[model samples]
Structure formats: structure tokens, C-alpha cells
Target: MSEKTSASRRAFLRTGLAGGLAAGGAALAAGAARADDPLITDLEAQPWTQYLGDGVDAAPYGLPSEHEAHVVRRNVAWLTADPVSSVNFTPLHELEGIITPNGLCFERHHGGVAQIAPSEWRLMINGLVERQLVFTLGDIMRFPRVTRAHFLECAANSGMEWRGAQLNGVQYTHGMIHNVMYTGVPLRHLLEEAGLKGSAQWLLPEGGDAAGMTRSLPLEKALDDCLIATHMNGERLRPEQGYPARLVVPGWEGNMWVKWIRRIEVGDRPWHHREETSKYTDLMADGTARRFTWEMDVKSVVTNPSPQAPITHGHGPTVLSGIAWSGRGAIREVHVTTDGGINWHQARIEGPSLDKSMHRFVYEFDWDGAPLLVQSRAVDSAGFVQPTKNALRKVRGVNSIYHNNGIQTWAISSEGEAENVEIS
Candidate 1:
């Protein structure tokens, strides 16, 4: 090699080394600046970092962290006469994603939770069938199994807000619902095994609890997407969720999904039980009643920045998140408005868009810390848009307590506190 080429190569190597050293020095200065943050500087001094955690055997069954103890199901004492026959609300504001944790799923009991031995559980198919059939839990599990995700919503959810906004928190007003994946055998497969008689038109599913909660379902719907479920969210059903077995009636109200389900009696006519005639029916202004109202309408609620979950971070870049669902189909879109209904921005829907399941959505914006009114409107695949409270009252007359799917509004102060409010 020539001396001139060697000298140029040596100079290029020296310059490259100097440039690399400068970049390294700049990175070191940035790291020194970040060292001032207490979270980074003191992290090694924390107990969790310095000490070993509990062994795996310490928690035989896993549990939530101590910091998350506040995330729980809550019940309103005045909502019912006694705790046994009351309903509890899910902590919707504290949850994320589309699926609700099994432990935190909202519960509604007419006679409290019934604890039954799986070995003694029996599902009897009687009336209007070629043969009376009784299948044990073991026998039911032997059939072909299927899994599906669905949302179960009580008919009376948000019932208290029919007249006006009475609940201060979204947990109490919109928490009587949960979405979970169920594993079970199709009801049609079981009915086919039992041989449904030609005269069969209706089915009466009775619960094993003391109240013996029973509801009449149409034969067509029963054969469509119903299931005799034994598992939820990949685990055995919880005691409050019906232990041994339960019924799944997709896209329908929760009353029809009988927990601790024991019997299915085929009949030719509807059985106007107390729950159907006196309890679940919607009273109209003309002294009439709307009965057999099964499906839950398209609904959405802003879970975060709610009354219980106030925005404590003050102003700056803010994240607004919520959930929307529909019994008819999937949620196609969700629109959020910060100035009541003056302006609406389409929220980005995240997670899976399953049919008859909850859909999570998020909207990010810069906040000026001004007093604002927050609201969300949902549009479902069926093209049904969520209505306002006053618009719903104009048609339904506020004489009933069931099936209130109106849009909810939360008034936010400059301080970031939120409260339930209805806008005209």
C-alpha cells in the first residue's frame, strides 16, 4: 500500500473514534439528568427491590395485589329489602380491556348464592319430549363442547336513572353487566338428544336456588345460541355464578340465563310467572305494560373520569376510555363529546369486536383544564344509535324501570371532579 493511502485511512479512523466518543458523552449526560428522579434513584432502596417476595406456595390460588384491594364488587344497601335478595355492581371504572375478571363480575341473586355438590347436580329435561331425560354433570360434560364470549346485562341496569340521574357513580348506575367467555354444550344438541316433541313452542328454565327463579323462553331462540354452560373464562363457574351449571341465552336479558340451572320444562305456551308479569315488565303511561322485552339495547358509558374515578392528574395530555356493547350485534362506532353534544369525536375502538360482547374504546386529547361536560354515544351493527335520557323519556314516558339504554353525561369541574348530570 502507498504511504498517502495509509495516512488518509489513519485520519479517517481517528475522526470516527472522536465522533463515537462525543455521542457516548452526550448519552452519559442524559443518564445523569435522569438520575435525579427519585423513582429511579431510590428504586433499589425500596422493600420490594431489596427483599424477596413470598413463595409460590404462599398463595395456593392467586389473588390480586394488596394495592388493588379497593377494586371490588359493591352493593347498594337501599336497593333491596335484604342483602340476600339484592344485586351488586361491578367496578367498571377500575377494570380494563373487554373481559371482566371472574372474581369482579357483578352478581344478581333472588335468593342468594346456592352451593350445590357437583356429584349431586342433575339436569332434567321434562314435558313435551319423547322421553323424560335426566343428565348428571358428568354426562353433560361428555357432549361436544363449544366456547363463546358474550355480555350478560340485567334488564334493570341503570333503572334508577330512568326518571333522573340518581346514582353518583357509574359503578352503581352501569355495573350490572359483565362480559366473559363461556364453555358449554349447545342447548339444541341436548334437546335433539331428548327429542323435542312437535308441540313444543316454549321452554321454562328453573334455577336450583331457593327462589326457584324461572323464565319462559321461545323455542326458536333456545335452539339458536343458547348453551348449558359449565365453565366461564376458562375456569369452573363461581358459586355466585352457578357452580355446577348455568344457562346462556345470547343477546338476551340476564333474567333468562338461569344460574344453578336444574330443569328445562318444554311447554306449548308461555308461563306468565311473577318475574315476567309483575317484576320485569315495563309499565307504560297509558296504564299498559311492555312484556317479553328481552334484548338489551346499544349502550355505552365513560368508565374513567367518572364520579368515583376522578381525574387526579390535573391537566395536560389526557386519556379518555370507556366500554360499549349491544345485544343485537357488535359495536360499530363510539363517539365522545367533551362539550356535551356540541361536538363529537369518533373514539378509536380497540380490542376484539366480538358479537354480543363488550368493546373498549379510547380517545386521547390535550386538556386545558376547563369545566367540561363528557358524554359517549354508541352505534351498533344494527344501526341503532343510543338515545338521550330526555328523548327516551319522551317515548317511554319514564314509567318503567327496565331497559334504560340512554346516553350518560358526566359534568367535569375545572378541578377534574366528575358528577352525574342529565342534559336537555
Candidate 2:
């Protein structure tokens, strides 16, 4: 071959090889590349890249990737007497967006998850109602349905932190909450069908679980946004979450969203049940107790860069994300601070800002490898602002466990390790 032809062919081969490497580098960077990472440089030799993967039938019901097994609902074994009657936290740091997955939603049970067949389940409306009635699961489904998204947060969420920073991770500190789209019949429609008596002013919803959990709810609230939820996130309710039926008391504590709900008794007065009187009430420093504190206050937390989720990639272009919510109304704004409240920056609120639902917020900045203190504060549409831990203590006192929506702080070290912390 002539020298000129041979040189042209060699140059073309070199250009083609460089182009391929450049394309592969871009793909690797998108997937979180490492300078000396074998996964990127030897991608073609990886087992999964060369093999035939599982078929469609492998997962009868779709499941998360095997790599995500670490993301799950977890319980602190020391928190309760038994697993059946205890609570498990959602892995908040592992999730994104507003909707919580059915499997990962937090679980709080008084007796344990009830496993009643849908065919055998029933809902009875008794008490002061004009017409006492019992409807089968199928019967309830026949009513006019509405779908709405809301965040159900246990009053005890962050309860452990009322005194100090106790839990090490966001999951345990603030994971007793989940947001999902619910499809169900309005409680007002059901009450009207049963004919509420003129004197009916309260409701006592009872669960079908072994514990038969019950709570007293105001009649006015029931007629407002309460729902007889049958499905969550477009699927039948998970057994841990109320199964065939549950109550959706928008903007209320999780206990009021009675799972395995089987009956609602309309009454002329509050039942002052165990949940409301002894357990869920807020006890004050002066020995006075606060009751009927139903609505969850404005709250926000830095989920990523929390103790469980630290910044793994060092130094530059760090993205911080978290969730904010309020039982009163939609969140109007969320402000983040990187220096323990000394300086605050407005975070960009992303996704739908629905009433009484979770809202995701993000803040991105270039990390300078300095030790940091991160926190987020939320403001709801009703003008309620999330309080600082000290500010909350001033009003509610440290003795109270429920409804503690104080801002949370995470101390980030120079190496990017995060720790749950409290700042004066």
C-alpha cells in the first residue's frame, strides 16, 4: 500500500477509538463515575453486561432493584415490647419526590396488622346516626370515589428528639410519615347516607386489628376531608397499612388515620379514648396537658446529608435534598442553612405543593471541604413557620413528645460524614 493511504487509514482508526472512549466517559459520569473505578473502565467485562438477565416473569409483582435492598422500613428493637404492636420507620433518605412507595411507607400498629379477607370485612356506622348501617368492603367501593394526595405523619414523629438529638439517622428521627395518593369515598358521603343526627358532633373510629385501636375525631372534621380509603398509591392498601380499608384524616396525626378501620360511631361528645387522653396528648412543664392537638405543625428536615445519607462524592457541586410538610396547608417556602442557622438560603421547591402533602426541596452548592451544619425551615401557606428546637421547647416544653416539629440539624464533617446534632 502507498504511504499516504496507510497514514490516512491510521488517523481514521485513532479518531474513531477516541470518539468511542469519549462517549463511554460521558455515560460513566452520568452513572456516578470514579477516576480509577473498575466498573467504568472495565464495563464491557462486567458479568451483568455480558449475561442474559431475568425474564418478565421473574418478579411476579414488580420489585425494586436488588441493589436497593438496603432501602427499607426499619424498627428500633428497643422502642417497643413486640414487633406486632410496634412501629417501623420509612427510609426517608433513600427516597425522592413526594409519593412514598406502598412497601416503604412507615407502619404504626397498636395491635398488629389485621389480615381480614376483603369479602368478610365490614364497616358499620352506628351511635347517634339516624340509620345504623353495616357495609361490606364491596359495598363501600360502590360509593362515589375521589383521589387526593396527603402526608400522614405520626404525632410522635421526631418525638424522641423533643429533649435532645437522640436518633442517629433521619429515618428514626422523622420517618414516621409517608405521602401517597389515596382513592376512597368521602366520609361526608357515607355519613349523609347513614343520616347523621342533629346532635352528632364527634366520631369514634375503631379498628379491626387485634388491638382494636380507636380514636375520637370531631364530627366537623369528618365531614370535611376525611375519607374511607381503600387504596393507596394506585394499589390495594398494604396489609401493614390498613389492608382492605382505613381512614384518611387529612392534615391529622397518623393515629387518627385508623388502619383496619371497621366502625365509626357518631356521638354527641368526644370519646376521649386512650389514644387522645393518655397517649397522644402533650404534657407541659407546669404539669398541664394539652389535648386535641390533632394537626401536625409545619415541619422540614434535611434528608440527604442526614446521618444515614452522607455526602459520598467529595467537595464540588453538592446537592442537598429533603421534604417539608404541614398539616394546616401547603408549604409556601423552605429555607436551608449550612452554618447552623447563621445563614439561610431559599431552597427550590420541586413537584406538586398539594395541601397537607409532602413537598420536596433541593439546594445545590459547591462544597469547599469545610465542616458544616445543615438545617431546613419550612413555612406553610397559613403563615405558620417551622420552629427551632429551642423555640419549640419554649412553648411546648421538653416533656411533650407528640407534635414536635422543630427544625433538625445535621453536622457535616470536612470528610462529609454527617451526624444528628442540636444547636443552641
Candidate 3:
């Protein structure tokens, strides 16, 4: 190393440092200029500023910001024949945190969302109960009210991918679920009001929709944590949801949470309804079907790097985030695998960690523009670990369409786009 070469290198380093400092100073100056001469600097001159704001009665019913118009329930046209007797998925990718907003929550109706007036709603307890009693909306509201948060997940949440990765977005694959704080009277109180007959072992809750959806719930569950909810999140239940009142079976299949609940008929046996018999049941390849599978297994999905939400920032510090939940209990932990299933890392679970509620989890890492396979695995408090598609298939078979809690895999290309992929 000659002195002349060393001097030249030293001079280059000094020039580079000065240039960098000057660029940073220029950025600061630009920021200061923007602060001084902001787009809204002359607020008084603007139309909104010049005119008085709309009066309190302008919008009697409040609505979300116009910018949030995209955040709403979406339905797959091909999935069902008619919109009336169909399902709409929640916009999970557009949502954050645990609670699913009332309007944004997914809607599934056998016949259609019944538009029943609160004043006209009536709940009747009959069948095996000692006394057959009918309680109006006012009468039911008189009972002790309690608020609880729980996730109501459809049994067929990820059923489309049970055979393979068919869906393109998180909303299609995992949006048939929602968590909300329900304010209502405990179902036990109502059952106690109409003393349960000793022979009562099952309770069949029937909806008031045109199709009259009905499902047989176990007596133990009815007496435990079930609720007859009237409000969701902080507002009255949406029309799509069971407005006025709906049965809430926490930590169970969403179907069992009968919306527009009208009747609770206690019985000694489970009614093999069309829902439980021909539909929700998981059929095996061996010609046998799993029945009464109400509880949703532990599951999680990476919402950020999913197909709908691709990585756009290029290589650097990246946050991989998603939600995990269980029908059994609170999510104990969530694991993320960036290099496929070969390597696994524990994700940080952010909470309120309420029982049977959605939990957010995040895994941060440095990406270097590498093509990768991203996946998330959840473990519930019941110690049930989420299984892979292959593992789930080996046990339940490919014919089964429900309870697909398989670890979802998202393949990220070198260009930073992501797609749903099934890996061996």
C-alpha cells in the first residue's frame, strides 16, 4: 500500500461521508419545508374548513370511513346458486387484531338472513323442559346480562383446501370465522327458568329463517358456556347475523350457533338433521363418515405474505403476521416456518388471549430476496397441535371436507409475489 494510494482512499472516504451527511441534511430540510407548507396548511381556505361541518342529524346512522369501503363481506359467486341461501366471507386480510367488526363478520344463511324486528322476536323453551314457556325480546332482556368474547368458526372454514390448495386468498381459505364480544344472557339462565327434565340430554336450537335451520346441541354444552346473544362487538347484531338474538355456542362449530334463534327443544338424543348428516359430517375414503364433529381444531394462517397480501418491500426486515385460534380453548403458541417445515421458529402471540378467541401472532425476520415457503402452526390450550395437510389426510382421508386445520403454505417467488402451494 503506497502513501499516495492510502491518501487517495482517505480523501474518497472523507468525500463520501460529507456527501452522505449533506444528503441527510437535505432530507431534513425537505421534511421541514413540507411541514411548513403542508397540503392542508391553509385549512380555512378549503371547502370543508370554510363550511360548517354537517349537523349531528346529517348522518343519523354512522358508517365507516369512505376509505374503508373495500372492507366488507365478500361472497363467491360460483360457491352457491343463490345469494339468498349462501355465505359471505369476512375480509380477514383487511382486518387486524382479534375482534371481527359487526358489519365485517362473515355471514352464512341456510335460507337467508331473516329480517325480524326486535319487538316481534320471541323465544320458546319446550319439549323435554318441565314447563313450556315463551319469552318475548323484552322478557328475555330482563335476565342477567353478561358479555363474553369468543370465536365462532365454521366447521368448513378451510374445507376447500382439504383436498389441495385451491383458494387464492386468506379470506377464501380462512375467513369463515369471526371473533366478537357478545353481550347477552347466559343460556343456562333461560334453561333454568324452564326447569330441565331429568331426561333432557340434548337441546335442539332452531332458527326462525325461511329454511328454519336447526341443530342438536349437547345438554352439557347448553348448560356450560352457551349464550343467547343480542349484541356483537359493541353494536346490535347485524341483519346478516341473527339480529335481536342468536344462540352462541363458544368454542364450537359456527352452525351450532343458530342465528335468529326461535326455539330450544330439549331432547334425549341428537337429531340427525340434514346439516349434521349429509353436510357437515366428514366422510372417509372407506365409506364411513365422522359425525357430530362440532369443535373446530387448532389452526392459523399467515395473512400478510398470503396471496392477497404479497411482500412488496423487497429484502430487509419483514414482519410475518397472522391469527391463530382454537375451538377447544385459548391458543397456547404459534410456530412459523420460513424455510418450509424444515426450520421452525416460535412467533410472538399478542393478546387479550381470551378463551376460544382469535389471537394475533407475528414473526420478524430479514429477507434477502430469496424464494421461500412460509407457514404457520398453532397449538391450542388442549395440547392439540395443528397438523399438516398430508398428516391430516392420513388420519381423516381426502374425502373429508370439514375440520381442515392443515398448516397452510404460502410460496413466495423471487419477485416477492406469494401464492398458495401444497408441499410434500
Each prediction's RMSD over C-alphas, in Å, is 14.9, 11.5, 10.5
Query: Mind giving the per-residue lDDT tens digits that candidate 1 earns over 227-264?
Result: 99999999999999988899999879998899999999
**Candidate 3: TM-score?**
0.88
Query: Which stretches in model 2 have alpha-carbon errors above 4 Å?
Result: 1-44
**What's the residue-level lDDT of 333 in candidate 2?**
98
* Cα distance off (Å), candidate 2, residue 104: 0.6
Clash totals in order: 0, 0, 0
> Which scores greater on TM-score, model 1 or model 3?
1
TM per model?
0.91, 0.91, 0.88
Looking at candidate 2, the ten consecutive residues that score lowest on lDDT are 8-17
| lDDT to native, each model | 0.90, 0.90, 0.87
- Model 2: which residue pairs collide? none
Ranked by TM-score from best down, the candidates are: 1, 2, 3
Q: What's model 1's lDDT at 9? A: 38
Worst 10 residues of 1 by lDDT: 8-17
